[model samples]
Structure formats: C-alpha cells, structure tokens
Target: MIFSNHVLLRESLHAVLSTELDVTSVGGDDGEALTAAHKIRPDVIVVDLDGPGRHGLRTVRLLVAELPECAVVALTGRHTPHALRQALAAGARGFASREQPPAELVDLIRRVGRGERMIHPGTALATLAAMNNPLSARERDVLRLAARGMPSAAIAAELFLSEGTIRNYLSSVVRKLNCRNRLEAARLAEEAGWI
Candidate 1:
C-alpha cells in the first residue's frame, strides 16, 4: 500500500513497486488511504512525507492506531533527524529518503512488509545522538502549538501563559536542543521524536 499526494511521485513509486509483480499501489492521503486500508488491509503502507498540507506524522499515528497489524514506511525528501524521529514515534516501521537509490527503496519496502524495521544508515547516528535529549511535557505542549506557526502572543493566549513565559519556554527548548533558532529547535524536536 502507498499513500501519496503528488501525482508524479505516486506514478514513479507505483512503477517501482509494480516491477515486483506482487505489490499493488493504492495511493492517496489520510481519508482515501484509510478507506483503502479498511478494505484491503495491506500489510504495509509506503507514505510520502513531503510537502506541508499532509500531516505525515499524524497520518502514521492514525494508521498505527487503527491498523495495528499494518506497517508504515515513510519516504521523505528531507530526512532530517527530527523528522526521522517523528515518523518513528508515529509508529513508522521504516524510514527512507528520496536521495536513496531506487533499489534500496524497493528493498526497504520488502523488508518492512516482512515485519522488519529499517532506517536510512546516514540518519541512524543522528537519531542515536538524540536519544537522551528529550523535552519536558510542558515544552512539548509549547512546541506542538508552535508547529502551527503561531505567534508567541497567540500561543500564550491559548496556553494561558504570558508572552514572556512562552518566549522563555521557547528559548529553553532551543538551548536544550542545542539549536540556534526556533525553527531549528522545532525541527530537532520533531527529529528527536518529541512531537
């Protein structure tokens, strides 16, 4: 099973999977994918994790929660350590970047379908390095709100915190993650599996 939002990538991926002579490509987003899953209950779902519209992490979470037997493999263009962690935390069984060769991707899909967990070798070390760098529960809440691109004042209003307090929390998150900017901090949090 494959769930993707882009036509070109979907077609290309389908072509790659079809070469196996057994794998079928059922591609779409959260709703369509869920419908297909309900009907076919595929053993594995290869999901594209690019672009902004699709909440890849949330999709993976839903799939894992709804279809416990199904395995998810995330395919991404930006295989940052943060995104890697988010996918895994959302119950992804495999993670591969678009930069990887097609042959390796096919192999990963097959392996994941057989109940194996896979990660891009390049990201493995960064992921390991991030293991002990967990954000506190409050920090996680702040970050989640920040992910929506909310301003400090808005986040403060929603979370019932002062603007200065929100800024303090954001600063703390950046320091803890060793990130120079809030964006980088958020990315690290995502990669570290905090989201």
Candidate 2:
C-alpha cells in the first residue's frame, strides 16, 4: 500500500512500485489511506511524509499500532533526522529519501517487508543534531510556520493563538537558537532539522 496526497507523484510512484511489487492499494489522503490499510492489510505500507495538510507521524502511529504485522516505510525529500526519529518513534521500520535511486527504494520496501530497520545516513546525523536543540515542540511548530514565510498573525490564526503569543514564541525560538532575528532562527532550525 502507498499513501500520498500529491496526485501526479502518487500515480508515478504507484506505476513504479507496481512494476516491481504487488501494490495492494494506493490512496490520496489520511482517511483513504487509513481505510485502505485496515481493509487491505497489506504486507508493506509506503508513506509519504510531506504535504502541509498531512500528518504522517500520526498516521504511522495509528497504522503501526493497528497492523503490527505490516511493515511501514517513511519516504521524504528532506532526509532530516528529526523526521526519521518521528517516523521510527511512530513504529516505522524503514526510511527512504528522495535523493536515492529508485532501485534503493524498491530494495528498502522489500527489506522492510522482511522486517528490517533502516535509515539514511543524512537523516541519522540530523537526528543526532536534533537531540541538542533547545526549543520546545510548540516553538518548533511556530518556527516551521515562520520558515514557510507565514507572519505572526497568519501563524496565530492557523494555530488558534493570539498574534502576540505567536510573536513571543518566535522571540523565544530566536533566543534558544542563538539567532539575531526570526528569519535567521528559522533558517538555522530548518537547516538543523529542528522544525
């Protein structure tokens, strides 16, 4: 099974995966993927860990707890250690990066199906660096929004908080990251995979 919200990318991934492996199902969003995962009970599930509306960690957590026999592989473009840790913490057994060749992803799926642990080296390093980060989870969230070019008002609206609170969060994030400004803080946090 495969879960992805990107229409064209999902289709392409489906095509490639189908040629090498028997894909039991494919879905566009959280609900569809969750339903298909339970109904089909596929041997392996490939989850895309991007997209603003998608919460891949939460989905993996649910699927892992429900389908212990099924292996889950998290796929991402960033190759961040924090993302890798989040995936593994949610019970994902494998991590695949977009930078790798297609053949590697196929191999990762097969290995994961056979019950193996895996992660890209870059992600591993990021995971280690993430351990040293000082910001809280909420701070990370605010910084992530800032990294996306979202102002305090917009971030506050999205997070259901006051604009002043959002600014405070950003200020704290800057201090913790040892950055001169919000942009610098966001950039450093992003590069370190803290957000």
lDDT of 2 by residue, 2-73 (tens): 887766667788888889999854655677777898899898998887845668777788789888898999
| TM-score of model 2 (CA atoms) | 0.69
lDDT of 1: 0.81
Worst 10 residues of 1 by lDDT: 20-29
Model 1: clashing residue pairs? 81-191, 82-190, 82-191
lDDT of 2 at 126: 74
Candidate 1 off by > 4 Å: 129-195
Q: Which segments of model 2 are wrong by more than 4 Å?
A: 128-180, 193-195
lDDT by residue (1-195, candidate 1, tens digit) is 777777788778788777873555555668777888889888888888884476777778888999989999998986667778678989999998878887888888889889899998778877777677668888888988897799999999999999999999999988888889787888767766566
